[model samples]
Target: MTQQSLSKFEEHLQDILQYRVEKELLIIKNYPRIIADYDRDLIIELMESLLNNVYCFAEKTITITITLQEKLLIIYVKDDGPGFSKKELLTATEPYYFQNKNSHFGLGLTIVEALTQKHVGNLKIVNSIDGGAIVSAVFAIKVENLH
Candidate 1:
């Protein structure tokens, strides 16, 4: 995640989630200060889609966490929902592939994957050991003043 003020991004995320989640439980882990280069609008769109997918399957709570490493930024959106099947894991990000017939265009993960690549990032979807889905978006950030 890149922002002049990352808190603004967090606020934006909370707004979107609050709107979509209605009265559901949401746990947003406080993020530390992180400054990097990123497209604000694109990040917002990416997060919106990710949250939408989580909302689709979430039962009660959703958790959002962000971590910044020396050369990477990782955001994990975890939900207490049914995890993905083996087949879904492989093709979830493929265009026009819908696990649920009534779901959205199946473009949520696709767009996220594309945006991640565009920013030299990676996307991972895994089933949490606690029996939920965890979607992680990892971005490579330029490290300054390397020895």
Candidate 2:
């Protein structure tokens, strides 16, 4: 893990967006200007996995929000798709659990959970009462690292 600026992370997200054009989905990101100590590659992989999973079900827009509260860095990825079913909300992060048996291998959330935990973080999967699905990753960070 290394200290990384969110700007650099956003740049990586833009690069990931280039290869995905199956849907006309608009990705909106809200990130504060802060640095956190995290594995850059693993965070990127986590974001990619979140985005890829949402892409398969998102209607038009996806939002990525990053915020810092105290010593925790919180990353949330939300989609304008059908919210997860109850069963999915419970088992989505389980290995080899698939909501749709056709296209997905069912490892995306599982991977995200693992990556989050690896960084001393916890993952939350929930359905927005308004609509869509929201995945939140919260990581412990050094308070001094905030800039």
Candidate 3:
């Protein structure tokens, strides 16, 4: 874990976005400019997994939203795609729970879930009422020198 600025995180996100340029998907980022303590690499991995999963199923746009509430940082990745089925909502975080016939193993959400747990955080998988899939990760923000 290390102290990182959100700008640096955004830059990493841009790099991930570059990889999927051929798909021509629209990505929206909504987050604040603040420093936080976290495992930068793991967080990047979490984002990559989330984005990759969504990118494969999204129709056109994907939205990433981050917000700080109390002492928790909430990160939401949503996609304009066919939302998860009832069973997926319950088992998506389980290892080897693949919904589509892809060459890759179905460990994306499992990895995300593990990383969140490593940070003592939690993960939520749900579908937006309007239409889409939304995956949220919440991590407790560690404040230094509070005294």
Q: Write the per-residue lDDT of candidate 3 for residues 26-133, one digit (tens) a residue.
A: 545555566777777877888888887778778877888877675676889888888999999999899988887864678889989998988889999999999999
Superposed Cα deviation of residue 39, candidate 3 (Å): 1.3
Model 1, position 59: C-alpha lDDT score: 88
Candidate 3 versus the native: TM-score? Answer: 0.85
Steric overlap count per candidate: 0, 0, 0
lDDT of each: 0.77, 0.81, 0.80
- What's model 1's lDDT at 21? 49
Ranking by TM-score: 2, 3, 1
Q: Which ranges of candidate 3 are over 4 A from the true structure?
A: 22-32, 100-104, 144-147
Winner on lDDT between 1 and 3 is 3
Model 3 lDDT, full chain set? 0.80
What TM-score do all the candidates reach, one by one?
0.84, 0.86, 0.85
lDDT of residue 9 for candidate 2: 76
Better of 1 and 2 by TM-score: 2
Q: Give the poorly placed runs of model 1, Cα more than 4 Å off.
A: 1-3, 23-31, 142-147
Pairs of residues at least 3 apart in sequence or in different chains that clash in candidate 2 = none
Put down candidate 1 lDDT per residue, 17-101, tens digits, no spaces. Answer: 6666443655555445655566667677888888877777888888888766666768898888888899999999999978777
Error of 1 at 69 (Å): 1.2
